[model samples]
Target: MCIRVGEIENMINQMRKSLISIAEETGLNSDDTICYSKKLDELITRYQRLKMNNKQKINQKLKIVTG
Candidate 1:
């Protein structure tokens, strides 16, 4: 299944909330909190990369059509 930008955004939001809750409950240095933080970082990075790629694709298409 293709994951759209909105789905990734929702996942990012959920991950942020989960990370915050875990840190608050277990302390910032706890292993679980650190793990969630790392996962959140990964999700955010993925989102950024996907958005950049989409923008580049759109630019390429526009150039092909109008250049």
Candidate 2:
């Protein structure tokens, strides 16, 4: 059940879109909605961090192989 980076990125994009729609419709009036939005933001931030880390790991591997 290995998923590719592209698939993971696509899933994140979908979640981002869904979150945006929810925010637009809800307007953050409810505490629950605001909390949910915060969670989504954190999720996206984590995904970005993971992606950056992965890129850095690959670069390190490439550097080792070349050097």
Candidate 3:
């Protein structure tokens, strides 16, 4: 599914809050905390990838226009 940057940002914020709450409840090294941590990591990675893809597309368009 195609997701906008704003949506991804919102998800990231929510995930961060959830991770913090989970970590606080169950020690950082606990299973639940670890699971949330990995999920948070995945969200961050997805956000980074999305940004990079957009940047690359912009650069490609610029090159074509400037050519």
Computed on alpha carbons, the lDDT of every model, listed in order, comes to 0.93, 0.75, 0.93
Residue-level lDDT of model 3, residues 17-57, one tens digit each, is 99899989989999999999898899889999999999999
TM-score for predicted model 3 compared with the true structure = 0.95
* Winner by TM-score: 3
- Model 3 per-residue lDDT at 59: 99
lDDT digits (tens) for residues 1-67 of candidate 2:
5555676677777777777777788775766567767776776676677788889999999999998
Q: What is the lDDT of candidate 3?
A: 0.93
Where is the poorest 10-residue window by lDDT in model 2? 1-10
lDDT: worst 10-residue window of model 3: 35-44
